[model samples]
Target: MNTTKAQILDGKALAKKIQSDLQQKIATLEPNIGRPPGLAVLMVGDNPASAVYVRNKEKACSRVGIASVGKHFSAQVTQEELTAEIHRLNENDRVDGILVQLPLPDGLDSVALLHEIDPQKDADGLHPVNLGHLVRSETGLRSCTPAGVMKLLAEYNIALSGKKAVVVGRSILVGKPITLMLLEANATVTIAHSRTQDLTAVCRQADILVAAVGKPEMITPDMVKPGAVVIDVGINRVTDSDGKSRLVGDVAYDAVAEVASYITPVPGGIGPMTVAMLLSNTVLSYQEKMTI
Candidate 1:
């Protein structure tokens, strides 16, 4: 057991360090910027998960001295209203970042709404322009979760160049962007999705493996290669046989940790890192706007 246990990549610690650095940078720049960096999070309805996430973001902004210009709209709010709000925020001098909280309402078109936000002010970094910049290897705001994964990997000095990296799941959010990032770092990247054949064989070949498929504890120990660096980015809530509920990632933490050289915990891993990257992106936008 002792021999099998892997080193823990403490994302929470790295996130704290990132936030502290951002706070210091904000303090130093706020004097010249003339106003605090502002992030506008627009939530259309009361999604419990989204509410929790928004609250955490607001609290993080407060800690970093950024202004939270949050807007909570009724579930019945129309698409045109949300688009107008995004336009207003795009033109607002005080707001550096704007993001529409995910899973907006049943009738809402999330992709359209995301497109409405100006790419320069897109805090989540999911806009087509930013994604295009990523594909072209140009500097641009990046999707928070994938950026967090890259940051975590960097914090531990994990070498990505020339390594075989496999990303399970091909979603634009975490999987696709992270694959591109790994490729940019010169790692040979393979992205596997639900339809992929021989998934276990594919995953075992990776020196660096990232799981972001949103399934709870789906990647077992057998799927992992010994001495591989494992980054789990899935956050899922599951109830135990005893009816106790808790969060878990796509990789089976305890089992996979034994086989992998490094591992990240469920709740304390990518979740905090995602929030940290959001703050970083906001600050970056703020700096860009102030200088221009």
Candidate 2:
């Protein structure tokens, strides 16, 4: 008997469908609510990657009929100024969601600014209060990347209940939150980091493995369990033989795909889903406001 290759989890197609569904919901809410859901994005400095991400988010908001307001501050902007801006957005009636792009300029405190945003308007779901809600298993906004990953899993009908899951990486933005989400779904979760010994052995035990270590090709075929579902969350740029740069994931897709039962491709996998979930968060924030 011969074995078949794993199925590919197409995030692009799912993201497209999600955007279309959001557009219809936004259209319905606009007339009755008297205004579209508005998202305020605060970007500091000019990191090229950050610029691309912010632009993509703006385009996603436009596609779903949500109004996006962007505020670009200089690298020299003071912490006081940044916190003040967040406070302003918190009080703005029209701003349904607020997102502060990560990796602020040197000397600026990202955590302090994140704490200043009203939890209700925290579109990125990184605020301590919102994260606390997730940790407590309460109903509230979740980090976009983790939410997107879970959405992808649910779409494929991957059963998480009572499964063994290994998440490589412990970052607040992706790893820790994802582990929590998996646990919420009844999966026994293990979070591995740079300090973990025998990481490969731990990963091989997972029924569902998530690679988010941010190192290109760090999770190879040897780390994967036969028939395990693999989700790649790392997006790193590397120079090709021609000296041109390209994006790749934490997992070695070619090698891992040969063994895994299912896999998400880089660029098209977690990337688009992140944007889709952000739009979903905006709509959810609006709905929450209406109920109050």
Candidate 3:
């Protein structure tokens, strides 16, 4: 008897489909709306990875006919100044969505600045008001990464209802929101983290396993249930032999792919979907504003 290997969840292809749909939607909306939806990106300092992410987001906006406005600030910008800029964007009629790139300089308070953005324009969906709406199961924009994960699962026709789902990590950005979204879909969800006892046993019970623990190669084959769906959300960079750096996911993909029924690959899986969802949210925000 031969065992079947897991199917790869191709996020890039799915994201392209979503982006194309959004482009068509924008075309229909332009005449009534007078112009394309606009997204304002506020990037602080010059973190290499953050720069890449912001650039990709802008490019996505351009592809979908959304106007992109970028405000790049120096590392030394003050918290008060950042808040003032957020207020300015919030008041701009042309700006439909606002995103402040994360990891501000050492002294800046990210959480405080998050609160300053008008919830209607919070493109990243990190504001307390939007998060509270999500907690209450009300309609509001969702965090891009978690929203993207749900979109990926739905695209593959994976039913979350009645499944035993486990999310490893409880970060506000990814883990907590995804767990809630799964629960909203009627999946029994468990959130585990670094301090979880008998973590392997807990993970092995999951029908759908999500690894967002931010550590490389943490979810091995031993921790997975055979035929479970594995979603790898951690993108860790490591130096291979000969000092070459490469991106690797939290799940040991090569080993876990042998046991799991389906898996998402690093770089190509969850990453692209995030930017796609952000564009979706921006368009949705713009449409919502028009109706109000």
Candidate 4:
């Protein structure tokens, strides 16, 4: 029943370009800095998907000339032990960034652990200091995923100024920060969540719609306004008719693509951009150390 076609946002291409630029920049700056930028990604337990993400981040760091000083711990690793490691990384001069992988095994106080990480080296940008800086529009490491969304939008020359932007979801990771970022770009932002009534009606009011609710195929064609730009930040794995697992974004891609003017594909879109931004933040922290 779909007929019209929309242009792909192509975040994958932009991410590749960003990594290449970072690689070159690192090559040039290493001599003066005396060491490559280092990012420590601490992962606990063996969540298969989390492992994959950590591995991809390490690979990206290596390609960009950032040192991966990451670590892994068993699911039963105690909070005290993790805190000690975070403290050590925070003080190490070589470590420019420190990130605690999320959804830590049960009984771990992730928020408390996040609080322990030095604000300067908070690579994931989830630290209160960094988040506060974001709220105040100061220069600091930003949440990678949200920053990536903005970067991709800019890369495609999409105008956000005065645009009606609706973001579905209220999570701190993507929704809130992204709303602030869009507001900074002069876009009018409305954050809709589960409590929002008539979600489709609210979504249809946007010139720019961002779906970060983590629900697969939640945003169908009818929810999208024709000619709107849709950014899908949700990645969900679901089995298909063939019983094969595949990744899908919050928006129903095929159906929505027929309505929106532009859209981002899940596997190739936000995933890579988030990693790229993380590396970028690590390098930023690295540069700051050199000037100190």
Candidate 5:
């Protein structure tokens, strides 16, 4: 029996290199622009996970010499109030990127707020204009998570052209955007969701399998094709049978790693890549401003 383990897709290492490059790029650009690139991350409520994510983003911005104008608000902040804040940031000359963290407090409309951000400054790349550009395959900012996934694949020189790609989620956050991106690369893509029939069979058909279903260890060995490359985008916290709390992806890592040719580990995989792409987006926006 051939038992060669899959080569690990080391996103953490790639993210570090990306940051280093971005930092050097910023160092050269700052003197010309008269100000460093600024990214404004507007965070509401106090969700612990969101808090940690926001903190990490600000720290990364600092390391790359980008200014962090992060705003914190209570869970009870009104929708009108949030919209006004977004508008203020839109007009701020120094701020090149604006992102409202996900999973906002109940009764708030995240979709409406996202629409208010200027497309050029939409760092999360969730705004309608940016997404439309993605559909048309035009030049524009793309969603951070999906952009990160594509970058990691490129870094590893994974061949997507004419390959069968399967994305196991339908959210705008990862699945839909990623499917479009894969198609752009000439990958015949299928989007499998919670309601899909014969999910395992669909997943097995993929040459490049992407899991972003937000379920812990949902993708198993049986669902993966032998010699396939797997990208795990879901990050879920769960207590194992031993009662230990840990972070795990949608793929059952250990078992599936044995079956696939390449796989990305949870925590170290999509997470940092997503942040790196966010910073990259900010820098791109800043550079575009110089030309305009």
Candidate 6:
């Protein structure tokens, strides 16, 4: 029995290293900029997951010497109020980056709120301007999760040129941006979504397969190509038969690990990298602001 496990991409470790690097850069820049780079994460409502995510992001910001200007609004906050707050952050010179936490209160329009943030301060990189820049292959703030995936691949020297890459999702947050990044790296890109027919056949042809669909363990071992590089961008909380809940990615880790040459584990994978890229984007904005 061949008991070889795939090499872990180790995103947590890389995220730490990236943070350390950013810390040093901030240290040097603070002397010139006169203030630390600032990031504002606005959260609406009291969703437990959003609370935890916001806390984590603020903690990461503090660790890397970036000042956190985060705020939590009431669930009853109006769309006009949120948009007004975003406009305020966009105008705040100290705030190098601005992000609105996802899944705002039911009546709130998340897209309109995101649109109000200045593209330069749009740290989440979901602004239409940034997305347009990505499509045109021009330099701009790229979405965090997909950018983190590309960074991990580059760190490990995984060759994307002329390779068959498949991304199994269609979310603006991950799927679309990642496909663009892969194409920029010279990969033949194909995106399969919920409506994709013969999803298994489509996935099996990938040399580089990325699962960003929110489904838990949707990509089984059979969907993976042998010796392929698998990147799991899904984060789903699942409870086992015993009733203990834990996070798991879209891919069935144990089964797929046996066949994949490389893979990213959930919890430690992509998650930390996403936070790291947010910090990077904030610093980039700070650097540009200082230069101007």
Report the C-alpha lDDT of model 5 over 1-292, residue by residue, as the tens digit.
1189999999999999999999999999989999999999988999999999999999999999999999999999999999999999999999999999989999999999999999999999999999999999999999999999999999999999999999999999999999999999999999999899999999999999999989999999999999999999999999979999999999999999999999999989999999999999999999987798
Clashes of each: 0, 0, 0, 0, 0, 0
- Candidate 5 residues lying further than 4 Å off, grouped into runs, are 241-243
Per-residue lDDT of candidate 4, residues 183-231 (tens digit):
9999999999999999999999999999999999999999998999999
**Which is the winner by lDDT between candidate 3 and candidate 6?**
6
- lDDT for residue 62 in candidate 4, whole number 0-100: 85
Candidate 3 structure quality by residue, lDDT tens digits, 60-151 = 99999999999999999999899999999999989989998887879999999999999999899989999999999999999999999999
Residue lDDT tens for model 1, 1-292: 2385899999899999999999999999999988899999998888899999999999999999999999999999999999999999999999999989888888989999999888999999999999999999999999999999999999999999999999999998889999999999999999999999999999999999999899999999888888999999999989999999988899999888888999999889999999999999999999995668
Error of 1 at 214 (Å): 0.6
Which pairs, if any, clash in model 5? none
For each candidate, what is the lDDT? 0.93, 0.92, 0.94, 0.94, 0.95, 0.95
What TM-score goes with each of the models? Answer: 0.98, 0.98, 0.98, 0.98, 0.98, 0.98
Residue 34, candidate 6: alpha-carbon lDDT: 93
lDDT of 4 at 274: 98
lDDT of 1 at 68: 98
Q: Is candidate 1 or candidate 6 better by TM-score?
A: 6
RMSD in angstroms, all models? 1.1, 1.2, 1.1, 1.2, 1.0, 1.0
User: Candidate 3 overall Cα lDDT vs. reference?
Assistant: 0.94
Q: What is the TM-score (0 to 1) of candidate 5?
A: 0.98
- Model 3 poorest ten-residue lDDT run: 1-10
* Deviation of model 3 at 107, angstroms: 0.7
lDDT for each residue of candidate 6 in 1-292, tens digit (9 for 90 to 100): 1268899999999999999999999999999989999999999999999999999999999999999998899999999888888888888889999999998878888998888999999899999999999999999999999999999999999999999999999899999999999999999999999999999999999999999999999999989989999999999999989999999999999999999999999989999999999999999999996669
